[model samples]
Target: MPSPIAINPVSPSHSIFKKMSKSPTNLPASAASYLSAVSQADAHARARSLATTVTPTTTPPLSMSSSVTVFSDDNVLREGEPKMFDNDDGLSYPPIPPTSEQVFTTVHSEFGHCANEEYRFTSQHPPGKPVPHHKELDPPYYILLSTYISYMILICLGHLRDFFGKRLKPSAYTHLLPHNGYAPLNSDFDSFYTRRLKLRIDDCFSTPVTGVPGRTIICYDRETQDYNANLHTTGRRTRGLNISSYNYLGFAQARGGCADAVAEVISRYGVSCCGARLEGGSLDLHQTAERLIAQFVGQEDSIISSMGFATNSTIIPALVGKGCLIISDEFNHASIRFGVRLSGASVRTFKHNSMKSFENLLREVISQGQPKTHRPWKKILVIVEGLYSMEGSIVDLPKVLELKKKYKFFLFVDEAHSIGAMGAHGRGVAEYYGIDPRSIDILMGTFTKSFGAAGGYVAGKKNLMDHIRVRGHSGPYAEAMSPPVLTQVMASMASIMGVAPEPPKSANGTSSNTLIPYPGPAPAHMLPNWFDLPPSLKDGTEGLIRLRRLAFNARYLSRGLKKLGFITYGSDDSPIVPLMLFNPGKMCAFSRMMKQRATPIFTVVVAYPATPLVTSRVRFCLSAAHTKDDVDLILKACDEIGDWLDLKQGVGERWSLQEIMDRAVELVHMDID
Candidate 1:
């Protein structure tokens, strides 16, 4: 038998590949040569075949392959030449990065580990409705249109328009990916949708939502197979009780301060500033908005950006560079992961929300030092979220602050899903824990979810804001937050602050207030001295009433789901209610049944990439607008669906609130002394 081939484990800095950079002629005749199109597993099979083919002859010298070789047509582009290739192949290949020197590839150890479908997001499609195709005039439609115009000749001195919709709505096949797996050199394209229609998915995820995403709103039943795609829904004009939208505090309502501000700003600024923040896109409204958000969140200053995803992905690089370490929760959003990668900082992940894993990982990294170098890290940032959007779990802010104090590390928090929807004062995790917000070094959140606005904000000390303002990648390149969006956000903040004065009762043909104050000086801190209500806001009115109603609805939903024997994820205090179905097939069934029920329950069915493979879920966001009866209705329908599918496993054995609290407390104290 051939002697066992030995290859040392390689680091990114110096791989086993360097040793294989030998001439092709120098390799023994028995050496293996595999095609680049094949996966590492296939390559391994070929290697084994080659190993047995030689019958234990002297080992052949390994030779690296050249990626810069000529094409099949003998075409070769010189350096700096524009890329030219043929489309006749009809295959999309990973670009072979050109290099003069030979580049040897290695096999991955965990090649088939990703047999599960949760690895779907590695490809572009992920798990959702397909992106609509661009518009084009159909030839048949154009012919029919011309005939009508020519036959009648009743031209009304107006430009002709295409009545027929041209945007091709993708079917179920578009949502699927080819050759999905974990880390691998390549994939095997085995599964595909054949000409015969297999199982049909409704593909109505983008079914247009009209008016407010309140307790009840008008929704076009795209589930109707023959429904056409348009700005307005023509199918049945059905009203769905919405639990899917992330209008947590119910600020997205049409007759609110948020909507009013949007209208006023649109009339004044014409929608957009049409430039980057530095290029006059930012107005005084933007500055005022930032300052108000900072004060409300208890930060010295803050910076606002047009895109929420960019806030994390861009600011992280500005904060940390090489030689720094970023310890992040495994469940942190993809934006945070991308940010850490882009920052060039060494990243380590602990178990999701496990304080024990966190401290252990922190201890290990601090004791062992940086990878390869064993040198001390220049700075370390421990990043976490106030509330995980997927799991709906809350982070123990006090415990995290304690750990930060013990380790002397900076704490960066993403409150995107929590800020306006959490705490007694709607501040976030810090207030939820009754801990000072000042303990956190970097606070980032988005105005999109709870505030019903279209941007994100990063709040911290003045110096931190200044550093990001000058060095951050997000603001200089991307367009500034739209003026209307900024106004809406500012108005929302004031509503939370309770100084969004009640609009005068006037019969000016407007049910909603058109004019709103741009928010006055921070208004007093909401929880100053605890239970001390701000004078302007009565003890039980304005923002307080909304907060109370939302809290009650959250608890009602949580208890109801529990009673149904359906497993739910998230803290009792959180408005993000994720019902864990685990089975992907079940998730699809639950989603369809919920919508097609006697009373349609609109919800978000998240599978694979969003949650883990088996834990695919249908998440319901609570709103102040949801009544007790609404919660009961959802619980009843979900119970019926779960029972009909025989999904109840351990309803009677659900963990108690006290048990959860005790366990959390125990974990926090495990390594304290």
Candidate 2:
């Protein structure tokens, strides 16, 4: 195995006992209080780290392989302090609250303040306008060559080190060797890729973060002495502008209407649901949430699962069997693939978001039928995501629906990233395209992305949902969604749908029940009688505001970067914007540079395996919590860093950094060919 790269050397000087850096002077009370509280917590954490320090001889836990998201002690508000931090950090807060409205009660760090209605935009696709396809931009020749060369160099160096390390340092190779007649746990390729290539840039991934991962996330400062085999917290924190987390509508918060409801539910029902759905775990909240979700997605019924991944992986098998076929998009999420693989159903993938490719493949499969026996398949399920996570592309739902009508395949649209982020009313790709959501056979989505909650849901006809509730793996085996999570989902979903007036009661003082139509308000009785949202949230004004702000930010950021001469991917309305970095070295450099800026900006970078090898890029997940100024800050950072890293090799109508920022609204509205 190749020796790991040394990122930061161990030293006593880096200890937490060292004097902390002074926070910015003249901060607002909320900002000062938050910073002060965070400092005290850091001191306590350092003391604990000292007590638990391990000796050099001890084997360190390899935490570098996974991303770490930790909630800090800061989540617990100090006594006498306001529950909401409207100005938790100086960067996110507005200079003056909107005078027309009542005092803003939101934590600015969680949801940014942008009072200008002009800053908002509806996310619906233009009528009669062609649905945009995924556009791939190529970099300059030398850039591509260097990217390939960088990988080649890394591979060659990794092999050379592995060859020598095995012979020279036999102790490290013990695990790989057949000792005591047991087979090695990991393959040679896995070990080499991990130790050599991955370790070098491990610092860029899975960074330990503390506090709410909203507009600004607080990352724990840590260093590794022995490459990335282990991480050591230095008892320091860096509050960076977070363009990394999947907080599309900016619902992820420690203090909000939704959070209050969640806290109340936790107090009432505790955390766990006690058991699986089929067991004694199901709650009235689950049924209510399912009803609201069904209404939200225009489905007759819905089923909730405790986990997002399991919702797909578990229910998929129940939907299909051995003789069934799953026609999937090439770039579908891993969870979808896992579910398809377990179903024992045949799968055929088309070029991602390419309607022509999908149509051709569908025709071929329909004609040829099953393999070997050449018998007609029992059923075919076509699966695609409403929005691609890595590529930031929106699936051409109109085209897919067109094909579905002709081929008669069951359509499944995964709206994990699209729900609560797309559409004029925040409904998903179907709504974005001005189509009925029920036109698709199945609509699967997760609360983790846009709802600021946990778990997933499957919505369709009442019979289909009833079948899934009974036959799905999650029903009998998996634990049910927690009470707090269920409450959060209900509160957030209700806030989006708005609470409708109670139906007229008869002389007996009892009202009849009725299902609320799609895009309509939730019936007032569906929510807990004690759960009362603020006027803004109850009326769905806040949700509408969030949706519009998210659309604007998404469009402005994606368009601004493209005009600044960087190769980018995805639709203009997509909150997920991917700026191509190409080379692996550049990926690390881009992330580090952005994070190290004056107003530090945290971003997610992707390379081979997660994305295509040569198209290594930084993905900026725009949020409704971000203000117009936040988008400008991101564009400025990217422009400066892109120029430094020689990344502006994209072919486009180039605009200077200032021009792009100045005319952002115009740029957002500009037609893209």
Among the numbered candidates, top TM-score falls to 2
Best by lDDT: 2
For each candidate in turn, give its C-alpha RMSD to the true structure in angstroms: 31.2, 10.3
Q: Can you give the TM-score per candidate against the true fold?
A: 0.62, 0.87
Residue pairs clashing in model 2 are: 67-206
Listed per model in order, the count of residue pairs whose N, CA or C atoms clash below 3 Å is 1, 1
lDDT (Cα, tens digit) per residue for candidate 1, span 1-673: 3212111112112211121232223211110222232233234444556544322111111111213222322122333332221111111111222221212121111000111111111001112333222121122343335434532432232112111111243232333323255343322122211111112233435666555555555554442222222223234344446788877766675543355557766766677775323424467667767767887788888999899999999999999999999999999999999999999999999988888899999999999898898999999999999889888788866678888889999999999988877767777777666667888999999988878777798999999899999899987897777777787787667666665333455587434523222222234322111122224232224455456556656765665566455667765556887876654456556776776665566788876456664566778888765544456567667777877865554334454333433343232122211
Give Cα-based local distance difference scores for all models: 0.58, 0.79
Which pairs of residues collide in candidate 1?
Answer: 392-570
